[model samples]
Target: MYPAADTATLLIDGKWLEADDGATFPVTAPATGELIGRAADAGAAETDRAIDAAAAAFGPWSAETAYARADVLRRAHDLMLERAEDLAVLMSTEQGKPLKAARNEVRYAADFLAWFAEEAKRVHGRTIPSNRRGHRFQVLKQPVGVVAGITPWNYPMSMITRKVAPAVAAGCTIVLKPAEQTPLCAVAVLALLEEAGLPPGVANLVTTARPEPVGERLLADPRVRKLTFTGSTEVGMRLAAGAAATMKRVSMELGGHAPMIVFDDADPVHAAKGATLAKFLNTGQACISPNRIYVQRGVVEAFTEALVARTATLSAGPGTSPGVSIGPLVDDAALTKVQRQVDDAVERGARLVLGGTRLTEDGLDRGCFFAPTVLADIDETMLIYREETFGPVAAVIPFDTEEEVVARANDTAYGLASYLYTRDLGRATRVSEALRFGIVGVNDINPTGAQAPFGGVGVSGLGREGGVEGLDEYLDVKLIGTAL
Candidate 1:
């Protein structure tokens, strides 16, 4: 996984071009801080070329029938599944998730392409009712011109597919900027699309270490009709604001401080297992990871015991290692932030039930490894209660009633995903409906998919990313009336 084939060029127009300034950035594995590859550090000029190429490609690309676009996407999907091992290896090397998890992500990424490939054929317009007897009315869904997609490092392959697949399926050309930390994956994805018979310039890639300047250009460009981004809340807001200045259609899948609530009626062990999986998957780096855990007072003790015990079993190591469920934080900053959050939580009266320190022993000294942490007695007064830790730390807060827990869970500026576990169906229904998140998992920790609508409410950012609704984000509607 460490010596994956390194890609070091930008995909502008139909060609792979090196930056004119010859700037490059080193890509190191968070698992060991080992330099795996180098990527071209694109800047404003490269971004401008990518946008211009996407705009030029949009005309012929969008003019193609939906079925044609679907054919290319379908071919890419097959190629991904065919070359799954290579992609998974590269993903593990670059992203620091387990090889198994990387494999799963590769499949999930391919699944998006497959989902949208079939969905593209169903992009249908409709006949509308006419008020006048001698007139006809029609509604049409057309591709929004050029699309600029900015993706994050976590689940790099899947995020790109989740974004680019829909935009392509909707017959829109795109310029993609993958997270600088993991640009090789994006380069690999564009290569697959190229082999899938996608016309050159239909999908351009701009890999850059400096995103602000490149992002500013993408958002400010009048030719880029749509902007889709998946990253931090602060960055997403700034990009959304810039897009608004150009009146661009913007969809942002930003940060989340997801809540997982367990009722007393639930089996404490079962709820704990669900909570462990939801909280620690991808080492708790996922946007939808349950950052906050709420348990009813009657079940809190058993839940905490089970959760702590289960979390202790998660081994944080190189993602390439065997049976390793948890992996290193993506960088030193992430490790520092997780450490700060845990320290703040403990200082504010929360109990560190287990693991509150960074991992430096047992050959973990070189990596950004934090132990799988579990804290109890978390309260609203604690900093961890409000911030998205984005690490493998679970802070448990005990609640008295369903009403109180729901109120506590909804108290967040971010609302991307939430979860509830209860044996009582009525309680589950009532609680699920009460949560103010864009997504709720009732008795289910993993609810999102290629076909599901993935996004958020409030400052969690704008628009949906998956399902038919995702395609709509890359499209514009028009009503046409003709006199008979």
Candidate 2:
């Protein structure tokens, strides 16, 4: 996953250019707190340049045949898949995900490229049969000019590719601002696109030291016609509001406190495994990952026991290690936040069933590492159950009935993703429809993919990110009528 140093070039208008500011920002690994490498610190001027580039190419790119665009995406996808292993290690070093998970992210990200590549050829206009003689009506979808994509640190490669691939698939050019902490992978993506024969300005990357000025430049610029963001709900709201000032088309996939409900008839062991993976995947940093578990009282004890055993056995180490199940938090602040959450929950009377402390030994003393923690006997009033604990922590609560579980699961303001485990078809059917999440999994932990429509509900943010619905975010509908 190492960069060739000389190849970390910024692609603008088919040319590689240094940030006009002539600045570089150092990237640090969360596992060792050591310097990884420097990424170009794109400033206001550079952001403006990228936007201009995107705007300049929008007309030509949008007017191109869908087959042409699909061809480029397919090439990019094949190249990305071929280099998945290298990209995975690059992500592990910069993003602090386990190497295996990093590989999955690279593969997952590439799948979006492949999926959207095929989707590009499927963007068809609708013919509206006119009632009037010698008159014809047609409704067509046109690509929005330039898209400003703001991606988060978690799942950096996948997030950037997910947004940019669909936008390009819809024939839109893009100016992408990858999170400051993990911008290298975005650069690598641009490299692959360059190799795949995407003309310059169709996809551009910008790295920055300050989020405010760069974000403002992206939002305030009229050339940037659409805004897509994935991050905290608070930040997403602010971006959405700012984009509104210019009436920019906007889509957001924000925060979540997803709920996992296990019915009485579910296998306790299977339910526990799902809960563990869903909660602690990427050390629980995923926006849609399940945060709270509500088990029926009949199976609560067994589920808790199995969960505790599984969570306790998880080995916390560097993400590059082969057998490690969990890795360090993204940074020091995230580690502190998770610790504060556990402390607050325990102070409020939740019983700590497994882990509650950070591991600060065995060369991991300085790293941002928090042990996989499980708290049982948690109540609805507790923050751990009510808020998004974006860390390696799981809080479990017991419920009496399906109605009660559904009510409690939907109690939060965020309705991003949820999980349910039930052997009874009646319960599964009734509960699946009863939950208030945008995406729900029945006896499954991993539900998101390139083919499925992925997004959030409520305060979770607006619009979908994957599937055909995703391409719509970067398009405009136009109706034309004519009489012959």
Model 2 clash pairs are: none
Q: Tell me the TM-score of model 2.
A: 0.97
Local error of candidate 2 at residue 66 (angstroms): 1.4
Q: Estimate each model's TM-score.
A: 0.98, 0.97
C-alpha RMSD values across all candidates: 1.9, 1.6
Off by over 4 Å in 1: 1-7
Error of 1 at 79 (Å): 0.9
TM for candidate 1 is: 0.98
lDDT of 1 by residue, 1-484 (tens): 1123344469888788777798889999888888988888889999999988898899899999989999999999999999999999888888999999999999999999999999998888999888899999999999999999999999899999998899889989999999998998998898899889998889999988998888889988899998899999999988888888989988989999999998898999999999998898999999999988999999999999999989988988899889998888888899999999999999889999999999998889889999999999999888899999999999999999888889999998999999998888888888888899999999899898899899999889899988888888888999999998
lDDT of 1 at 271: 95
Worst window of 10 by summed lDDT in candidate 2 = 1-10
